[model samples]
Target chain A: MTIEALGQVNVTESPTAGSRSVDCFEKLEQIGEGTYGQVYMAKEIETGEVVALKKIRMDNEREGFPITAIREIKILKKLHHENVIKLKEIVTSDGPEKDEQGRPGKSSIHGNKYKGGIYMVFEYMDHDLTGLADRPGMRFTVPQIKCYMRQLLTGLHYCHVNQVLHRDIKGSNLLIDNEGNVKLADFGLARSFSNDQNANLTNRVITLWYRPPELLLGTTKYGPAVDMWSVGCIFAELLQGKPIFPGKDEPEQLNKIYELCGAPDEVNWPGVSKIPYYNKFKPTRQMKRRLREVFRHFDRHALELLEKMLTLDPAQRITAKDALDAEYFWTDPLPCDPKSLPKYESSHEFQTKKKRQQRQNEEMAKRQKMQHPRLPPIQQPGQHAQMRSGPNQTIHSQPQVAAGPTHHYGKPRGRGAPYGSNNMSGGGPRGSGSSGGGYGVGAPNYPQQGGPYGGSTAGRGSNMMGGNRNQQQYGWQQ
Target chain B: MAANFWTSSHYKHLLDQEDVDMVNPLDKEKGITLEDFKLIKMHMANYILKLAQQVKVRQRVVATAVTYMRRVYTKKSMTEYDPRLVAPTCLYLASKAEESTVQARLLVFYIKKLYADDKYRYEIKDILEMEMKVLEALNYYLVVYHPYRSLSPLLQDAGLNDLNMTQLTWGLVNDTYKMDLILVHPPHLIALACIYIASVLREKDTTAWFEELRVDMNVVKNISMEILDFYESNRMFTEERINAALQKLTLRP
Candidate 1:
């Protein structure tokens, strides 16, 4: 299902008094619903620009999107860019957004029982790359494929170069504008990379199919290569009809990676022997069927580029710049213009989907009149992490929420790594000034300038899950 | 922070340096002005850099902090509350959001040392209290997009190719902390600008490579000039000069 998202919906309609009820949003209808929330096709009553509105019900004390939503608002406010989807604004019957100044500057029009839920405003978009490819009549010639790849690389180039790894680099994450431009959307899974990165990253980012091998083997310390690996998967999927390494689970995903990329030989890849979880698989393994063998009829240049990108050793895999610079891409057959590609009118289901949303929203609004029993106002701090099993148990030991840091709760580690520091540094509670005055002040030494920062060495620090003997390198894409 | 040219803070706040007004927070328009963001910028830098500094992560993490700060302030006004409070709050949130956790205590302590007063503010107890408020105000849009991730490869493409990661990498990281440059150009453009400028200073033959590339020359030049201007004003190198110019302002750090 597809929904629109964009920035700059127009001030004319949003602030109007019943020029149309909030219904100008047209709440056309829902296109899809997922684990966290449901998405709707909405239109601005003023300019009639369509947008996708994702509404997540904060039914429990544990829901984090409220926090995530606020954080996204904060960052998107400043992150103005062409390749990124603009978060125009956020609306909610959740009472007026709390003034940052505390009660000092509360607005008068806020909190009239009519408003209580939250609604995030984004630029309306047409379709995502994956969905575009799924269109019944949509077809890409070889040049068209190259064009999409170039755009993808260009967008990724903007992201990775900015030190952000869109952990989820699948086609679904890349949205295409009607103008033939591609914009990267959904920062819900993205993170900014700091030069002084130390605490091992968590294994929680990208979905399983798009996950890099290092992350699959539980290595928190990884970089843009992880995203590149996903892009490689997406590129391959663009060529093939289905997902590249459609592993139902983690182990299966790892196995599929080993099947390709020649299974981590000590020769092509060194240091593979050092990971704590580096399980010694059969040394005598078969080479991955090269792109040449699988495709059978792909242009040699395309095959060659794909092969290099999906290389087992991430260090050797072609980078976004290299892919763009590839002779195959720049050769006699240049990429096709994005505009020349045919676009399909949204299915009737798209329109019907809009009307259904209106009915459902009215039902929700009526139910909300009495204050939903399921979503009472969060008057106080709410309990988080119901997934907690007796403080500090193995996250993997439990079946779900396996991505939440791999630390043992309770007493901090003694001279070893801090407890549950898989995603953090001290394993102490968040460095927030929860009590009142800024607590982190004057504690850590100020960052000095000149050469590299002093804390750059923290990369090798002991992590909650740092000691895996086998650092699995699944090169499953392409 | 993938290359959206218009909505970014870069196009929003990068104004020509006019006389800065501490009392007037709305003065920061022009691509991205720093004075209006003095509270937010330094607070975010100290909070994020301190956290990342303590954690020993990459400048990538620090850069992420700046990105989050800009992200939060984009749709928000500094007046609803002090950006100082929002700064650390955003940093804490960004840390968690980025999956580079700096315990709440550590972040608070760092803020106490860097921003708050010792007699009334450093009570460790007080800063922790501010956390919830910070979360409430931001409405929790914690995820951020930054430029540090893109710089490395763009330099390679521009033919200014292959930066000395040790120096250039950190240099690019430092540039993010200079101002919210991440809000304007995409991360790689900033990286390219940084590398391109370094090449010019080093007297390297970068012309052949730069000329062969296909990009907006104005964007490259604009990014380079911003960095240069920031470099000239840095306290690390020219505090003596800047301090003389900034002696009139006696607001909180």
Candidate 2:
């Protein structure tokens, strides 16, 4: 019997029948590839508003819908904050229509072509933090870094208070609009966790470089402290102009973290040896934490906060709320207004990576042309030329001007392909080549811009769960 | 939102008693009365429970799946969205949304094995297709705050640490799902109502504890009355009555 035979009657007039059709928005250039599918920059036909339409990939979904997409939509719907990316209404495309490129749609389920496509509409942002930082000759001033950090912490604090753990916190996921307003995006890895310590959350979350030491040692039970570790790494990256720990794999990742943060032991972390992989990956020798020594040039308050955030013990790691209250934020060169930060052309992680790949290809072609004088220069894809001439190209022509000796461009590090890449393995996404701190050198410092900052609006009087409750009962409580 | 019921979609979607009881015009045109609609939903909720048992998901998954099925019928008609197909599809979607994913192939395997009837037997494609429709009908708000999350905490606070009272109260919360109390009341309030019922049955005093919660007792009484009414009427829900209600929907030609 068919679905139609089983009472699949047309109820299009019903208020909940379907969302506004995807026809309302005209598809623009693809901005990024999300965990499921391509994220496109589209313009609304009615309002002329630019939006990021994240296509929910339906092909090969053995289960009905992707759990990651469901979690993202659910979390985004509940979250309403200035620093978090807003998910506009979800829209659907009609059956089997050819795309803008005149290619047949691949909307299918279990090898059977499905009728429509689902697109989660989100407010469009111009640049992600990685793309902005990766720009040649681009450097964030002290105040600018503070501004982004404050926003990041504010956003993260809101998520934590809401009981949502953004398991994936990295440079590419932090989207920055033209107004220099940073928003925490990509909630595919985010899940609502409870205070119950018995709940077994997967340890395989967060990108490799920014992954916390506890997670590297295979601790299944964790909390908001995990995200704080990544935030600390990001804070140090902004100050030093490179990633603090760029390890290649899990074992080396633990090694890099131990080398910087010192190896975890019962004395420092308390019950550290009880962690699942603690014995397997335990350090052979005790390593001294030289955070202050290595970051001697950093502001004293910044160093203090970093120490708390990068604490070997998950229990001791500073929370987003406490981090916001740190003396570093209150010190001189306070975070300026997000609007006052310099507005550059649109630069997403996807686009910049493509641009970097194009440049590498061009350099390779140039060297090959010198070797074989008679051969014509390699013709790159037409799309690459279009991408190269995009608005961000003007900034690309500048020479690699370093801000200091510490600002050398390290090679791009490897990281997990965005969350939800593996459905069955239940592990985190597999590692892919991510451009981390390689292009952070040669950033031109900006003047301390904008007026005295109005302090963060987050964590103030929002009636979040356990907002006023005692935290001593939770395992993550310090 | 999962922790706080106030800002959750579950809170936002809570309907009035009349709104929850209102039968869809399309279903009405198909000769399905208000009683028939309720019976049909109740029957499908049971169907979802059995399917969930076969799939071996948690009680939370079953609760979420049943809640999804009920929510679908609120905006959709049983005539257009068949309760037979919608019931299983909701379980499938809820399993994934709740992070206890059961494959579509497994669901299809169980459906064919459980139901010999052609109407109840759906292939994997049909369930997958209905999943999209269910997602659309839900407006993609899959996060459901169940009374289960609040029950234990309320029980502990009320000092009803006894095993029998806890189990009885938990069963009452489960029974609340068979009705539309989930659609009308906040989850915590529902938990409170269940505790109120259990205290009376076990002959315990929780009035002081309930008072300290600072919630309006009137709403709790209303929800408690609804639960009692469901128990009173469900005794008369015979197999023939369920079949009669199911027969009201116009079958495919």
Clashes of each: 131, 3
Task: Estimate, for each residue in A5-88, the C-alpha lDDT of model 1 and write its tens digit.
Answer: 111110111111111123447677554443234456798878888877755334321212333343345445534466677776
Best by DockQ: 2
CA shift of A388, model 2, Å = 20
Candidate 2 total steric clashes = 3
Interface root-mean-square deviation of model 2 in angstroms is: 14.1
When only the first chain is scored, the TM-scores of the models are 0.62, 0.74
Per residue, candidate 1 scores C-alpha lDDT tens digits across B1-253 of: 3234455333443322332222334323221234435433544465567656655655655665565555445444454434555555555555555544455567656656654554213323333333433433344434333445455565566555554643664575576465756555555566667767877776777777777676677888898887787667565434353332223232332
Clashing pairs in 2: A138-A443, A139-A443, A401-A442
The number of the candidate with the highest lDDT is 2
Local distance difference test scores for all models: 0.49, 0.70
Residue by residue across B34-151, what tens digits does model 2's lDDT show?
8998898898889888888898989999988988898888788888898999999999998878877777889889988888988888888888889988988888877777788778
After superposition on all C-alphas, the RMSD of every candidate to the true structure, in Å, is 18.2, 11.5
Residue A366 C-alpha lDDT in model 1? 53
